[model samples]
Target: MISLRRQPMPSTRVLATRTNRKTRKPMQFRGASIAFTLILPVFLIAASAATQTGEEGSIELVDPKVLRVCADPRDLPFSNEAGEGFENKIAALLAQKLGKTLAYDYYPGATGFVRNTLNAHRCDLIIGMPQGDDIVQGTNPYYRTTYALVSKQGSGLETIDSLEDPRLKAKRIGIVAGTPPATNLAVNGLLGNIKSYPLVVDTRFDSPTSAMMEDLEGDRIDVAILWGPIAGYLAKHAKTPVKVTPLVKETSGPRMIYRIGMGVRHSDQEWKRLLNKLIAENQTEITHILAIYGVPLLDENNALLTQ
Candidate 1:
């Protein structure tokens, strides 16, 4: 959200010269044109200054003084600044290493958070950007996971591997709009038959997953595709005992495997490098962080990163 403004161009004047009747002085006109060219550099400098002024209060990661972080306020299991969520834990760890106070810019996990907050410099780092995404510069993935299709136990939809299975073609699958799992389903032409919801929903009960689980319990949707941690959590606590089936492969769909990583501005190479090093050094601690939230730690290639 760095604001930019264009500077006004320098004014130019035409010089009229009276020669012999119809003959005009080409040299005089050329000289005036050259003068305008000579003033162009000053205009360029002024434009740059204007741009800097517009971005005066914006956050910049190059500053070594503090580390500002952006996170979703309600996306638990991922982030919240109120001493909950895994991303908050990781951000604290990063701040501890950098010897700076952790400042958070909280926003709901919506489509605009990235463009409005993260890119605007409200925060210098985004804790859980999906790896390989081009919208933000992402670090090497620290964790990997597969989308899970959850259903009430013995619901006759158990042991499903692919969304394209004939049994699921007519069934309603609940998917969070704009998530990687939804995209995967769309790529495989499953979106037409799926029921989608915004990733962030108002809490109707204790955990955020309650509403979705209620829908499952009511038979509103035959199946639900959610991130691994969320699916696992619901499966562990649900009264109906939903089965969590990890999706590993599909022929024409989006890749079932995805890696999650931290995001920084592309210009913040130093910060990116430093965070990567920190992740590598604190592998064990990060594993513990994931375990706290029940996220599976996997190598960049989707293999297990820890025993």
Candidate 2:
């Protein structure tokens, strides 16, 4: 989930912010080390051959020295211009490893995120992207998470894990119109009974979770289903007490859980390899960062932070 954090004012990407979660599939690939285990030598050669990687020549290096990052200046949880997010921290770590200065190309994370930055050569990397994202050459996944079920702390629904919870049939729930959770709600015969929020939730102005929390606080809904990381973060600041739990065991076709990673230009083979190495080397540090942000992580067994 991408939360856009602004420097002065604040904006949030809500993670799956740029991703159409309802339609996009979870990223699947071998472990980080396995991703490049067979090509370590290839990477060594590429590294010696050139300091940069991407489509043939036609390059405009960002000073040919700094680790230029492409990111939304206001997105939080992921990145921001002020270098305040986890992605920013990871970028700093990468720069240290590369012996390069850290820089950024500020751009709103939307349809043009890649085009205006990484593709334009204004920056060399995007700190967060879904693995297997066709828009860019993504590194091996560093983390995996999922949507969550959120509700008032004292509400009888606090322990509810699935939409099939018996209580939901008679209560109003909040869900984003097109998110995967909505499908779960629909299949469980609750779609017609809940409030639907817009998918493009902007944290600076308003967000799906924020709006749902409002209704929740107002006693307008019984529960709110949101992406786990966003709900976990927002739930803490909510006016009323709330409970957040990963919806990992939800029975659904197309998995609700997704793995996230950093991305480079599609043709940047060497860049991709280097990032995989960074992720493999710093998985613990990255987990600490996400934990600080209240991101709820799940293991392959659907165990909490199961890594």
Candidate 3:
């Protein structure tokens, strides 16, 4: 009965510095305008030896001795100051390729993520952003993923591929308030019937996906719908087996797939180009990293990532 936006979380402390903060090279998304409109806007952070020239039509200054990145301080599975998230692993891979060390500008993925970090010239990169994001120029997309339907193991729902499945008519499904999968549910005429979790949770400030999974496993909800990576990773981590079926089929409207890329200042075309080349040479390796974290990788046809 209610409607809302999309959200992308978890913790804390420490900073680093490297001498050579040089530019790096690079590559999203779906819908009929849906691809352009249903963007999954994420956050960025990290402080470093960089400053904007404050001049119009010029790129910001970066030290070249380090890879200054913007990221959430506590959002695990994605990123954190502890360098445990998959994004952290990939950022390190990129910095090593560039022959520089990693540094971070840390903040919550709240309202001011872009303006306070990347746009402020405090950090130079956001490891995971949608391809068509307007805030910063995006490099080549390193991964494509879709939404997922999560259910308990042996729940007899593992084989379901689309929300249009008739069995779902009686299920108490859980969905984050503002994500693409929720949109898909609505398009399929299921919105008014499912449980709507807030896109942002104030309780310990955890990710809404976490709460959704808890509800699903606890039997408070029969199923949970979330972004592919989040659902895949969490499902892999559950103490009891869970089924994470990628939502590959939609009858109509906005597609649930999205392409993720690194983001840089619009003036940083040289850096963007550098990342694009790196992504090409390391595509296989990058895919491996995502797989290690159980991120469900999909192609345009909704097939699994084989290589």
Candidate 4:
């Protein structure tokens, strides 16, 4: 889930902006440091030889001197041009660790995000992508999260844990159409009162997440179901406190949970290995960053890691 944060304005304003984004399936490998260590040295030597010889199959997809990231110029909770989002911070951290300058290829995260940027080789990495996304090879998952139910604190509905909760039946709900949660809402007989926002939009002009949050705050909608990271971060910054309950209890339909990872072109096996090592080494710091951003983190057991 990408939230385009236009700079200078607050997070609320930024999150309201929309751009096209898509989700993909899980990758075949999870990050395993031992595997990377055993194979990386050979891979690097081969790549180096290829580069020195100007070989056609050199493993040099990205520029060697800089860590170039493909990012949405206006996305928040993920990235923005001003370098104000967690992804920006994480990118900087990785660049510093790798002794490379941090650079970006700015594009709105609307349709063709992967095709226009990473596949085009305009940049080398995307800071936040779902693990196993087919469009690009994914690093080991750095964090896991889920869709959540959001409501103002003190609203009787705040405690409702699942779509099957009886209290939600009478409430007007706001949700992004076509997201995984929408399927659950439909099957649970709760779609009738929903105010569905467009799934794919150009963030430069419209922001469904912001619209939904505005409606939620204004009482236009009694509750909302949104991606956990977006809802968690926005709720933490909201003028009125909001409750974010991760939808881990859903028993049917597509799973609302996802593991997130960094993305690179599939052919960049060495790059992917390097990033996996970085992620493994910096897991603690990364968790701290996510917590500061109010990202709702979950352990492998589906238990919440942050309030």
lDDT of 3 at 76: 63
Minimal lDDT window, size 10, model 2: 5-14
Candidate 1 on 75-149: residue-level lDDT in tens? 556664466878789888888977888888765444455666677766789877667666678888787776678
Q: Pick the candidate with the highest lDDT.
A: 4
lDDT of 1 at 90: 87
Cα-based TM-score, every candidate:
0.67, 0.77, 0.79, 0.82
TM-score of 1: 0.67
Per-residue accuracy of model 4 over 1-307 as CA lDDT, tens digit each: 5544321111111222334344444234456787898999998898789867764325655568788998877667777778988999999999999888999987666546677788877789988877656767888999998889999988888788898887888999998876777888898998898999875565546778888999999999999888887887788878788899988998887777778888888787767888899999999988999999888899999999953
**Superposed Cα deviation of residue 244, candidate 2 (Å):** 1.1
Alpha-carbon RMSD of each model: 16.5, 10.1, 12.1, 9.6
TM-score, model 3 to reference? 0.79
Which has the higher TM-score value, candidate number 1 or candidate number 4?
A: 4
Task: Report backbone clashes per prediction.
Answer: 2, 17, 33, 13
Worst 10 residues of 3 by lDDT: 10-19
Better of 1 and 3 by TM-score: 3
Q: Which is the better candidate, 2 or 3, if ranked by TM-score?
A: 3
Displacement of residue 24 (Cα, Å) in model 4 is 24
Candidate 1 residue runs with Cα over 4 Å from true position: 1-65, 169-172, 177-210, 296-307
lDDT of each: 0.64, 0.70, 0.72, 0.78
Q: In angstroms, how far off is 209's CA in candidate 4? A: 0.9
